[model samples]
Target: MPRPGSHKYDIKRSRLRNELDDAGIPDKRADELANEILRNPRGLRARLTHVARRFVPRPGRRGT
Candidate 1:
């Protein structure tokens, strides 16, 4: 069974992923940002910025 707050995190992650997609954020950056949050309880702004980095497209070659 999922513990308390587990479902909430899932919802939040989904929302964040959707937002990142809408914003055209790269998959790697978006995943990194989401994983970082789940991995630790860090500052708000820093985490958000990290997620935002995904939006920036890279030149040449497809991102993994």
Candidate 2:
């Protein structure tokens, strides 16, 4: 469990929350995600993607 009362932890958590929010996650969900990420032993070792977007060619167009 993380020490939510610590000032440093709070500051970091808030920063993570803001990043998540900018990533298009809802405020509530972002808070949850931040908590989970903070609990990781490696501390954000891997990139997280709630939804991955890819570039798709147009229906009738293809790379020449």
Candidate 3:
């Protein structure tokens, strides 16, 4: 069986992606950022900052 903490990583990452999506980020960009963070979670703060810089509001600025 997996250790207790084994699933934590997945759970945290999923939450991060969901937050980004809920905040109007695109799925493709969110996935890419999530993958990068997973690969180097040690500097997550910096990574997230970088990802934040990449986001640009959608052209129409309208919600679904």
Best by lDDT: 2
Cα lDDT, all candidates:
0.63, 0.70, 0.69
lDDT of 1: 0.63
* Residue-wise C-alpha lDDT for candidate 1, range 1-64, written one tens digit per residue: 2232597777777676667657776777766665556556556578766555654546874665
Winner by TM-score between candidate 3 and candidate 1: 3
TM-score of each: 0.49, 0.62, 0.54
Residue 17 in model 3: shift from native, Å?
0.7
User: By TM-score, who's the top model here?
Assistant: 2
Per-residue lDDT of 12 in model 3 = 68
Clashing pairs in 1: 25-55, 26-54
User: Deviation in angstroms for 19 in model 3?
Assistant: 1.0
lDDT of 2 by residue, 14-58 (tens): 998998888677889889878888777464655363222222244
Clashing pairs in 3: none
Question: Could you report the Cα RMSD, in angstroms, for every candidate shown?
Answer: 6.5, 6.6, 5.8
